[model samples]
Target: MKFADLSSATDYLASLTRHGVHPELDSISKVLSELGSPQDKFPAIQITGTNGKGSTCVILDLIYRRAGLRAGLFTSPHLLDVRERIRIDGTLVETDVFLEAMQSVCLAQEKTGVSLTFFETLTAVSFLVFSLSRIDLAVLEVGMGGRWDATSLCVPEVSVLTSLAKDHTEILGDTLELILQEKAAIGRSGKPFVGTIPPEVLPEWERQRSLRGFRPLLRGQDFDGKWEGETEAGERAFSFSGQALSGTYRSSLTAEYQLHNLLTALATVSVAPWPVSQETVRGALLHLFHSGRWEPVPGFSAFLDGAHNPEAAEHLVRQIQAVRQENGKVAFLSGFLREKDWRSMAHIFTEAGDHFFLTVPPGTNGVEPLTIASYLREQRPGIDCRTGSFKEICQSAFNWVAGEPDRLLVVTGSLYLVAGVQKWLSGDDSPLHAGERTSASPPS
Candidate 1:
């Protein structure tokens, strides 16, 4: 069926994913060319990495908006509405605008006679929407491995890679070297690049830097950040010295990993050609709140974190352990996609607690809850693992840790699972509530 409105349009786009990933960028490039190359109309800042890409992009978007610029942000795998993927001036683009852009993108695809994958269509839609809105700058986050991802077609003013890890090993290659090579390829020739790469990947990234002939803004060499201590409000306070906005920065984010992501964002914005004042940068961080990353549910004791991969899972376990009481019980309500390294991640959680309830991520690609529970059992023999409906699992987890000040309830594994719980917590139990756009603020 042809897409007739916003709902149908999103469904139609979702349908394209069944055809599998088409990594080549020729089709997206053709669609953009047919649409008059809207991507070229504005300056873009490209962000790519195995982890922390979405959080970093969101922080950069807020910072850019506070600088008095109409920033356009394009990120992937929206927690709620599909419109969340594309935002103008720190707000989601209206449904009418999103529909109009999708319509134009479909028309451009027809004219070019080139098939676009789900992400490719969204990439085109973002470019079209940004062009129509006359945005001052566009922040594009690479959907996956960046060599031929749809967002790689843009010519970025600065490329920021925030910490590479072994998340997409099946597609991007299993080795860290191979993965870094693919991600580092997002760097444009003769443009500034910044990254928080590991020492093992530094040689590969440096090689790419030499080949691309761009000035390198590295983490250890060009900039350094340290977590000083906690603020009076119980928030994390960090200190960094770099060419960008540097000082003792304070954040309310509960995860320690966010400190590195924030520094990477600061480095990117500092090197950009735009004029962003220290006051603006500070103000942006003060108001920053991206959902599904250590986000607390409105009226629940549980915290939601979308740390599906092993690298992020390690960080999450540490954060939980840091605040958890010595004898407090920590029950986990979690789900995961099929392709993720759930085994490695599941083992990491075993160290934090043995109480877990696994559920499916609400989609075709979701691994069965029973399957994940079985894996957890194998990882930690005699662990308390349960599987059932989303509601039952959530209620059970809450009950397990209820009213105990030190006892913790965590909804983790996948962002989709977190979104599912967020919907249920809002008094709307339907998983499809994410796609049902109404007159409301962006999720969380």
Candidate 2:
């Protein structure tokens, strides 16, 4: 297919990922080889886990770039734009550069007659951009289970796993042990691997590390971080102490649970080949901000978080309750995708928030908004719940929050919902307002 603009190219790629899973690296490896294996042109750090991987990537990128290294960061399911998935030296690659890299991958696929998944093509494009820009190092977040994930095509200097939980069970496995087995495959021989793995999954990770001849740096045993306190502005004061480095850092990021992700990133940096000063790490933490992970939208009184799964939802509830003032009304704007633990998520949010606004996420995978409304009612009878288009929900949420000074609004459940709500508020032409009809039953 011929493409004249980034939108068309991205739309075509998105179509490929619908009901997606072509879990093999042969096609991506071949396409990269055709393009001179751009992924091998630079050193990379691979990160994989069920959660906290994106936040860990963001922290590592901040530290590397702040230390004056030319850093390339590639993550998935961007919160605002696809360009956000690929960045060079702390800036999104220019539109022209993104399109040029994508075009090269398209040509390679046509020549090789190897169809690539949406994620595979984007991964190739990121490598191409990194090669063209001559980045010193790249930080890659694994798109899914790591064994055959497209982003695992590169040979990483360090492999980091943030935290494991129940997600993508159909593709990964039904149990945490099975899921950890897939994620543990990212570690290679002689490569430094680090992460916070649950006690139950430690044996599998150890087995992989032993077979691969790589030493695994455990989170609590090898390194740890503590949330020291919070400022009046809600900024967190945290400290990281490891065998190599120890320091107290301040961050504008307020989520208390992120201290675990921060420590994992710090541990990876400490063991990485690159040299970064404690001062640089401190500075980077102060300015670090990642969108849609307890991110507060500017010019609005709401916070956005992608707390899709039960584990993440538990964290979201704690964070909200911690910051909420006594007698303050907690208002929520939530939308979730299908196949998620919507019943658990509903109970969590309804317990934490006094009022709820439900909206459908931006695609066919969206769980029907009213389906969640029903779940919320079952959990909390007579709960203040309303549903409509994204804009309508936001308008209602804004009006409700405005009624009280101590009210706080949290937008959570799915990243797609946060992105859609952000676009609607930004006055962009967003797909969220379409609000297509659906009567799908909520997950059991």
Candidate 3:
């Protein structure tokens, strides 16, 4: 139950995959039962979406923490390491802590011989750790589909659907509406659920949520954004109503498409079971920051995002359009895994951004660099892309962009790619900027 046990714990956790194909609620329920029903301990703010769930979860955490509540957070596919998946009051649970939790889960599974998939087991550990920490609330992000997700065990007081789009077609469905249905499964009877799906899909989402027995808050219908003034920096501001609260503040993430997520977070907290004040809402927004949402990091001044899908890539472009002031070279550092919607996403980024520093980070879902570069070159005839060591490629891009301060270095493709950069630049690989909390976590 110490740090030295991590390797064995990891093997034990990995062995849970032998449970075979993922099933519905019962498979997950059995795993949680092994942990003594930790999922029932905390009131949760459940979030599910193709993208932006992570951002909204961060915003919810900030608001809850601002209101002086101990909040627990759980997200997927950590950028740097596994410990990022569990957090109490914004600080990540330590390595030793995770190893201990894993030991408990593995021992329970072994004794019971209860089969558990990777996500199910991890979700169980996160819930147990959070329950033991005595968090006032937990902001749980769904791994894939909404209804059957391991985190869906708890019936949340409020569920947030943050801006749906077409991404996972295989397991979910081929169309946006089908994917929306799968994601919208997070809703429960009488629970307040907010739809962050774009305006086009709002009608079906509305009908779906109503049939599911939840109060639905649909964007572009219930609330209206009025043309508002600009910040001194000339940022666009919109005043939107959230049944109970509204704000016309500038988003620091610099992604134009993030408005949907920001509003979704606003609506979620407005109808939350835990009471919050207007001052708490205002205070939270002023200092809000998610790890990688077109974030402008220091020194290299890189723009980081975890967009690996076609729709997400399109959203990132819209975000870039909002932030980019003038003409500048964008040095791209990217990677992708085998199952990614690469053909769809390829056109989204390859057509807009310059070229890429394609790489395959060790122990990651990142697509091989040669494969990515070749595909990118074929898709976009004029683009220049190359394969190289991830570290050198990231460094070269950063230095190349740093020389032209006006230019930008866009690092994306996968959270695994971002984690490789974070591990080297901010990890123990370098002493320059150590202990920095790089937001490398992303939804698969």
The best candidate by lDDT is 2
Deviating ranges (above 4 Å) for candidate 3: 1-3, 11-21, 198-207, 224-238, 427-444
Per-candidate TM-score against the hidden true structure: 0.94, 0.94, 0.88
Q: Write the per-residue lDDT of candidate 1 for residues 1-444, one digit (tens) a residue.
A: 245677798788888987677768888888999999998899999999978888889888888888889899998888768888988887778888888888888888888787888888899999999999999999999999889888888899999888888877878889999998888888988888988878977788778888878778988899989888743453567887899687877765537788888889889988899989988887777666777877765445568888989999999998888778788888889888888888888889888987888888765378888887888888788889988887888778777766767778888999888888778777763322221112342232
RMSD of 1: 3.0
lDDT of 1: 0.81
Clashing pairs in 2: none
Off by over 4 Å in 1: 1-3, 429-444
Instruction: Report, for all candidates in order, the number of backbone clashes.
Output: 0, 0, 2
RMSD of model 3 against the true structure = 3.8
Cα lDDT of model 3 by residue, 1-444, tens digit: 333665576676556566754648786576677778998998998988888888788778878888999999898766655666777888888777787787787677676767678888788889989988999999998988786788889879998887677766777888777888888888888988887567667777877867798888767766545535433342345566868777665444335666677677777777888888877876666556666566556665477777888778888877666555578666677778777886677678765677677778556556777887778778777688867887777767777777576776787777766666666666563211111223342210
Task: Go through the candidates in order and give each one's C-alpha lDDT.
Answer: 0.81, 0.82, 0.73
Residue 443's lDDT in candidate 2: 7
How accurate locally is residue 108 in candidate 2, as Cα lDDT from 0 to 100? 96
